[model samples]
Target: MLTEARLVAVVVTSAMAGAAPPGVDDDAFLAAMAEDTYELVAGLDSVTPVLVTSMPGMEEIVWPGTPVVEIPDLSGAALVRAAFAALPYGEQAVLLSGDAPDLPALLIGKLFRALGRARLAVCPAADGGAVAIAAHLPFPDWAEVGFDDHDPVGALRASAPAPRTVATGPGWHRLRVPGDIARLDPGLEGWDGTRALLSG
Candidate 1:
């Protein structure tokens, strides 16, 4: 179970400046992220929601009354770094991608439960990057970690301080391209958020 004082920071990064990919809409992606965050929070024992994003235009798209913090001129590693830096201290935060339509709430709970024993925990994506990460310390140097090589696990292993690092199995995947969405398990059919995006 997650500690009561810990905050569940949901990092919702957006690519507002770039043109929407061939089949993906920016609004749908943002909605999916919000839904994923909601699911994780609902299934968890105790959590405080903190939505972090770089898209200034997303305030209109996100859920009403959702507390949001905006970051400026950030992308890739810098974006992740800024998001972590913005989170309030003294609360354990879980960083999850805004584009993961199939993020399992159970898996998120498992990650937090594992964090009680380990220093860091991750849900690895099929494409080699991580869909989610739960850590006690903010990794500001993660900017140098090579995400382009599709070796986030390796990058994190080498860069992250030598502590108890654990992986929460292999069900998590990120939605970077259209093909990535098709690989999700059928269990996602029950998710209103997932159905809305896949139906598009």
Candidate 2:
């Protein structure tokens, strides 16, 4: 579906220092994300992915051929704008968090399919947050909505005057806090890419 349509998969990563959790090692997280991203791309028959990350020092950790676009920081609206601005125009971009290990490739396709009808399509996190957002149009103004807080979904819904929005059925989980990792399903136990971090 993505091959015929203009689409780009934007994977946003953090700088070396801010790459991982507060206590986890940055290199490990980068490596894990790189692996997971490769798996994500391999699983998809369509969609071209571009890996956009914050500043250097992590180049040695990610997969080869992954484009690394450095940004200032992850907080605030500037980061969102910078990330989107870096993307090539005319293609719908699907923004995926580097840490969302459970991101299903099938769902990614589903998101694009939904985007045909809805201005915005999101996969809500298990923690009442958003794990992914796919947009057919150019990036939306996230500044109008507060992204620093935990619940970006609610913010997007309230702030954006989008004509329509859709979400996938509940099940997706993001690995934010340590406890959040443990909430993953047992089937993912064997996928070390997801298990190492999610399975406490």
Candidate whose lDDT is highest: 1
Q: Write the per-residue lDDT of candidate 2 for residues 174-193, one digit (tens) a residue.
A: 66655555665566422366
Model 1 bad stretches (over 4 Å): 1-4, 16-24, 36-39, 60-65, 138-149, 161-171
lDDT of each: 0.60, 0.57
User: Candidate 1, 34: how far from true, in Å?
Assistant: 4.0
lDDT of 1 at 3: 55
lDDT of 1: 0.60
Q: lDDT per residue, candidate 1, 1-200, as tens digits?
A: 34545556655655521222467676666666556655556455666666677655656544575557777746666666677778766456677766665576777777677778766666777767666777665644533432223666566667655634544434476666656656666765335665666576
Clash count, candidate 1? 0
Candidate 1: minimum summed lDDT over ten consecutive residues — where? Answer: 140-149
